[model samples]
Target: MDITRYNSEAWDREVESGNVWTKPVSPELVRKAKAGQWEILLTPAKPVPDDWFPKLEGLRVLCLASGGGQQGPILAAVGARVTVFDNSKKQLEQDIYVAERDQLDIRTVRGEMTNLAVFSDSSFDLIVHPVSNTFVADVLPVWKEAYRVLNPKGTLISGFDNPLLHIFDYEEYEKGILKVSYSIPYSDIESLPKDQLKKQLEAREPLEFGHTLEDQIKGQIDAGFIISGFYEDNSAGKEFLDRYINTFMATKAEKVYVDKCRDLA
Candidate 1:
């Protein structure tokens, strides 16, 4: 929504600049991200469904936005031959360190998520995309590429914020048993401070970049991956909202929640 912050120059600056969170292997930010307890908060309380689990042994997997290897490392621990990919070299390198620490066999690669033709078509058994890709407005390109790279019958295990959760403000306040400052999606707007921006890059912000459910399901179908399962954990969002304004609803203005048709393409 505040994509104005991510101009073409900003994206390129991230590449040329060597800042940890901004750049990827940003050593300082990586360690900080790993050390922070907030990540544990973001993790799903319940395990992902069995059907969503990719067959680990001999299955080639790709992890997008493998920030500090949260999901990637977990999947790797389960014996998946995983290759973690991200635009941030610093982040990937940090993940590499974590993988080494855990003694997990995980590979790291740096590249844009939307275009994965660098790898062969039908090359992977599964793809794990977490809270990333919503930053790129056109997620279809990424989904299309993922389909191109995965073999027929291959699975994709992806997770992101439920769009419905996006309609809240996170400023500090209390009102209801669940204090809510509901707003129309993308209305309660504020520019992220520089430090906050880096923090977000380090800990993937699903709400900031998640596509609507309709689009996500459509992406799976169009890309040829069977939509095996979907998961939603509102505990974290609700918890966060209770302390801050739940911006999903209007705080200053009357709001309307519109259900627009989402493109699966």
Candidate 2:
């Protein structure tokens, strides 16, 4: 299956069905953001640390795979030159909707997260990526592209699911049981049985992939970013796992500056 095309259509359906992530922020939130009072979430629950951001005025920011009209508009309202890139057109439209409604300037680009060739090298000073990469099969390329497009010392704040969450059976999980049914680095595409896959397809749910901690964390480091901050969070819907363990993680990292050397006399 063409994962990109399938997930795009699935998420467009999500937008039509009013998924919480597809909802745009209220005008009052934009108003406060314009006045320098704002907070955005990388994880489901906790807002990103203010210190993770540099001064917002006039900085170029890329909201990577985060075009749900949430972070991009707020950052634009706070004076950042914001561009939102996502695979889902409906998701991007939410950003456009918020931008037009709030009279803020925000650019929306529809594309896959792994391929960011539309952007030039060092094009952005910061990237705010929420918990969207679970849909992508490979995440390392996403990190590499993010590194390539970021300026020296550029900040990247991202949220992703803990691979551990994928280990439990979905049916058992609903009943507050934690029966292990899958391994880490899980993919719904490859792991699900025919019946379950058919059910997910019939329900119009986007497929998910669970990347290991090494790929999600060390991948950023290998991409030349310095991991600076980290936090763990629980899922928002009062899931069974939330009572025991946080199922999400957010990380703050920065591209390091490298100086070219010249031969001395």
Candidate 3:
């Protein structure tokens, strides 16, 4: 399957279906952001720590796989040079919409998360990536590419699903039932039975993968980023796992000068 093409189209359709992630922020939100009264979600509920970010004015920020007009427009309103790179054109359009409406300067690019060749080395000072990477099967390349594009001492704040979130019957989990089923590093492409996969494909639903912590956390270190901050969050009643363990985690990594990072260079 063409994962990129498939997921791209799936997300475009999601925008049409009014998926929450695809919704654009209101002009009022942008106004608030410009006034120093704003917050953006890196996880399900918790806003990213203000200290996790450097000063917004003049910062070059890439909203990686984040194009719903939620993060990029706000960052631009807060005085950052914001670029939103995402796979779905519809998702990018949402950012464009907010940019035009709020008269904010935000650039939108349509592309995959793993390959960021569209950007040059050290092109950005910060990257704000929400929980969109679960759509990709391989995540290490994401960290490596992110490291390549970020300036030294830059910050990368990312959110991703806990691998434990995947070890269950997905449908049952939505019903508030916990059924331990799938193994770690889950992949809808490889893990689902043929009949179920066929159903999902027929429905044109976006296929998802749950990457391991090694790929999520240690991958950043191998890519030369120093993990500086971390936090866990739940779905705020949207997920049953919220009642027990947090199903999502966000990290703040700083690009540092180190021999380990030079390996990637």
Candidate 4:
């Protein structure tokens, strides 16, 4: 939705919305994101492996948003050659700090998540996007970019708040479940401070930033990457699943598949 028009004020509105960029991620919070924590907080019907990251001896991995570089460092420690991309200088600085502290070799680049074309196609073995998609208005572009840059066999591991969760108001429990709270085809309109406009343009888009699982799947397949795994946090329940189905997945997906793509030249 003409994401490029956003400024700092627009971004601040997003932060205040308590939807995207709800709170500034503190160093303490990033410190808490240890490996395998995903499994603990994000529940699944069955246990996924603690060491889900494949052996990193020679994998080329990309970390989006580099939130504190917490995950990037963990991946690098295992010997994967890692690169981290983020739009926020403050956040990337934090990531750099963590990388230095951990003695990791994660390279940082300043860029928007929806445009990964700067990185060559089939250049990476894995991509990690942790709960940051909500910050952007549209995720299809991000998925397409990811698929383009990721090797055919490369894997994408990501998570976001369940859309149903978006319908509730945490401050008022009674209003939490109301479906009319927002349009079913949600739009991410936000207001921000004028001084922050430039940064906002870099950090977020002007359009709404949520997607249904079907949208996520189709966007990826449309970009030429097969879905490998799909996990939804059951904690959000029917409401969120309902929105996800309407926005992302009207048709049930067949078995998710993962295969290797030839290297990008």
Highest lDDT scorer: 2
lDDT of every model, 2 decimals: 0.53, 0.93, 0.92, 0.55
Which parts of model 2 have CA positions greater than 4 angstroms off? 260-265
**Any residue pairs clashing in model 3, and if so which?**
none
Q: How many clashes (backbone N, Cα, C below 3 Å) per candidate?
A: 23, 0, 0, 20
Q: Write the per-residue lDDT of candidate 3 for residues 154-187, one digit (tens) a residue.
A: 8899999899988888778778888898997899
Top-TM-score candidate index: 2
Q: What is the TM-score of each predicted model, taking all chains together?
A: 0.61, 0.97, 0.96, 0.64
Ranked candidates, highest TM-score first: 2, 3, 4, 1
Position 31, candidate 4: lDDT: 44
**Structural RMSD, model 4:** 7.7
Please say which candidate is ahead in lDDT: 1 or 4.
4
Q: Is candidate 2 or candidate 4 better by TM-score?
A: 2
lDDT of 3: 0.92
Off by over 4 Å in 4: 1-51, 169-179, 190-208, 234-265
State the TM-score for model 2: 0.97
Candidate 4 has an lDDT of 0.55
Task: Give stretches of model 1 more than 4 Å off.
Answer: 1-43, 169-207, 236-265
